[model samples]
Target: MTTPNELRLLPWSGSGDKPCYLSTDDPDGYMSRLADSIEAIQLGTASELLEEASEALDSQGTSLDDMRCLVKELTGALRDVYRVAASRGHLLTTSDPREPTY
Candidate 1:
């Protein structure tokens, strides 16, 4: 049985907006590689959205409706970025050599 710390949080969610996890010993496996690709894409999207948000904020001609739409997209991107960060953080903590394994 795979432990929680050993499970990798997938880049996407399952039904009902629940988190999905991958349990695999092979980091180079198909699923793991797919997840890595997705995470990279998500992070890239978030970075682009952040730049767009900054531009919008600095522009005096930006309309309320445009800002609202940008906010919605930003919210989704932020969620994905946060999930990636959390998954990476968990992996780090579990695999860290400095931590004494029980």
Candidate 2:
């Protein structure tokens, strides 16, 4: 787990023109970009959860020990969503101006 201080590190660390521009854009467009980034982070987080669950099942036999069928089902679904959303958001971050180029 990331400590609070570790997680407090800002995703954007520099002060510059790109940061200023992203901060000041058409309201609707800015909102859309914000939504996109939020979705991307959510998807990445869900994917990490799925990976953790799969590892637990494979290594610890939680599937048989706990009889928690929902874990298996949810892990699969989350992994699928993670795959699609992460890919789209990653490409967008790389190619779009919504994120500052560093």
Candidate 3:
């Protein structure tokens, strides 16, 4: 069990996924190495999805339903990429002040 003061780094998630924690006391332990592997795999996947999304935009048929679905999946993948960056303490890109968020 993790102490209240300890950080529980949940680099992945869902109702089925379990929380992963590292002992701050041992920075290079087995669990720490495993977490590092998992984070790398996840970030690699994000890169692949980004590539796919770019391809999807460039070579797609003119079907409204398909376009909508592509946009939806791409949006989700981009969100995951941003989340991973944030968890790693990376700064998010600032949005244009004049642009509408919606």
User: Between 2 and 3, whose lDDT is larger?
Assistant: 3
Q: Write the per-residue lDDT of candidate 1 for residues 25-76, one digit (tens) a residue.
A: 8999999999999999999999999999999999999999999999999999
Judged by lDDT, which candidate is best?
1
Question: Over the stretch 47-93, how does candidate 2's per-residue lDDT look in tens digits?
Answer: 67667666876775565644466466666556546545444554455
- lDDT, candidate 3, 1-102, per-residue tens: 335445436466656765544445564767667766777877787777677667767875547777787678767666656556664552112335567777
TM-score of each: 0.91, 0.36, 0.55
Candidates' RMSD to native:
2.8, 14.2, 9.5
Residue 75 lDDT (model 3)? 76
Using TM-score as the measure, the top candidate is 1
Rank by lDDT, highest first: 1, 3, 2
* lDDT head-to-head 1 vs 2, winner: 1
Q: After best superposition, candidate 3 residue 46: deviation in angstroms?
A: 0.5
Worst 10 residues of 3 by lDDT: 87-96
Q: Which stretches of candidate 3 lie over 4 Å from their true place?
A: 1-8, 14-20, 62-83, 90-102
Error of 2 at 70 (Å): 6.7
The backbone clash count of each candidate, in order, is: 0, 0, 0
